[model samples]
Target: MRNTFDFTPLFRSGIGFDRMLNALEAASRVETVDNWPPYDIAKKGEDDYRITMAVAGFSQDELDITQEHNMLMVSGQKPAEDNAEYLHHGIAERAFRRRFELADHVKVVNASLVNGLLTIDLKREIPEEMKPRRIEIGSVKAKPKAEAKQIEADNQAA
Candidate 1:
């Protein structure tokens, strides 16, 4: 006997086929899928995040960070000097582009470059009404004096 798997049921489910089509479209639209610059994403706090990219040999003026729609784009370009002579060229100063997907409420906080690493911070502002709050319990109606006394005696015994 041979084991078999069925994919028809999965495709028939709601949005399953659309999800597959979207994945295919994304794969087809990738411009530089193989060119990946090293980066790190860290959680600064509950609603804050930081994205750090290793962008050595790139000046502050050569880097650009922009937010368009729901995408965060970071690109760097270093032009080669015409008069420079190199016996052996090992360093990579070529242009590169990096992108990140931003959530609906995510916003760029600040960006800075230190020691060859470019760090971009983001913060998601939660509305005051959306934040969790502690609710105060109001006092209950006055109980009968005899019933209250009986409850106190029961608590003392327990």
Candidate 2:
């Protein structure tokens, strides 16, 4: 059984959330999901995030990581091997591609591969102008009555 969601109600009341609603709609639709090369996403800090993938037998050169706008793609391709007979070919040695949707200002800070695991670090850096700031409310002082009377007398003498 497949379930879908209607985002029309949200659209009527929400503004500037088109991208988020579209992403949710895409996720709700069922598709052939490839489970190979399992991955994990964790939040290390307030604005720090990490994505780790189990890529056993995949070398650094064979893997590619790219970021286009708000999308993160990680793909792996193993060079074709010559005729090698295996008694039981149980290991999954195939090319696979994975994608992750990133929020605005979220950037890939670093990537490292260790012990057949690929770890990618991300950081969200909001611009100074976009951050919330405090506004100062100052008191408005009234002019003295003596100074006002002096100005009025000067105008009368002129």
Candidate 3:
């Protein structure tokens, strides 16, 4: 059974979270997503992440990876053979495309294909200005204007 949700109420009350709400709505709306090639997402370190996808029988030339802003797309298409005869076709070589949504400041650093597994490394590089910093607090002493001027005059006279 498929499920659906209405985000109109969330849109009215929520502030500065449009992207997150939209992603949730889109995920809920997707009913038939192809699960041909399995994938896994894991965190390597505090700011490093890795995504591994099973892409058997796919070469580097046949695969395509693209990133636009916070969206990553991976697609593969096997070239058709000129003369091939198969009694029972079992392996799936059809074209497939997959998308991944990335958070802000997360970037794709590297990608590699080995042993039919596609590994993509991601690193989160937050800007210095956006990072949290500590502010030093100090006490201030107030002095009267007339006394300050008198002390300055006395110092000048001496």
Candidate 4:
């Protein structure tokens, strides 16, 4: 059974959160989970993250990684295999594509393939202006009386 939610009311009231709501709706959908070429995501530091995938049979040329907006896609395509007779085929040699959703300001730093693992490093860089800062609050000064008197004298002269 799949649990579905009604976001109509939220949409009617909320603003500037369409992307998050869309992601939530997409996640709520019932879809088949792909287990092949399993991967792991880990947080290395406060602003650093890593993704590791077990791609045992894939080569550097056969794998691809791309980031578009907030989406990260990784795909692997195996070359053609020669025809051979096999009694029992247990190994999985197939093409696979995986995607990950990245948060705003998160960017891919580096990627490396070692042995059978594909590792990708990521970091979140918040712009200086977007970061929080203490606002200076000083006493509000009253309007100068000289300027008010000058305005009144000018009006009388006019």
Cα displacement (angstroms), candidate 4, residue 9, comes to: 1.3
- Candidate 1, after superposition: displacement of residue 44 in Å? 2.0
User: In candidate 4, where is summed lDDT lowest over 10 consecutive residues?
Assistant: 149-158
Candidate 2 TM-score versus the reference: 0.83
lDDT of 2 by residue, 13-42 (tens): 999998999999998986798998999999
* lDDT per model vs. reference: 0.81, 0.94, 0.92, 0.92
Write model 4 residue lDDT over 2-121, tens digit each, in one string. Answer: 689988888988998888899999999967999889899999999999999999989999999999999999999989987999999877779999999999999999999999899999
**Residues 5-85 of candidate 3: C-alpha lDDT, one tens digit per residue:** 888899999998899999898888876878878999999999999999999999999999999999999999999865778
Off by over 4 Å in 1: 1-32, 128-158
> Which sequence of candidate numbers ranks them by TM-score, best first?
4, 2, 3, 1
Q: Give the Å shift of residue 135 in candidate 2.
A: 1.6
TM-score of each: 0.61, 0.83, 0.81, 0.86
Itemize residue pairs with steric clashes in candidate 1: none
Q: For model 4, what is the error of residue 80's alpha carbon versus the real structure, in angstroms, after optimal superposition?
A: 1.0
Q: Indicate which candidate wins on TM-score.
A: 4
Residue 75 of model 4, lDDT score? 96
**What range of 10 consecutive residues in model 3 has the weakest lDDT sum?**
146-155
Give the lDDT ranking, best first. 2, 4, 3, 1
Candidate 1 lDDT by residue in tens digits, 1-158? 53444445666675637555454555555464645468999998998999999888888999999999668999998776778789999877878889887766699989999988999999998788877999999998986666444333444653
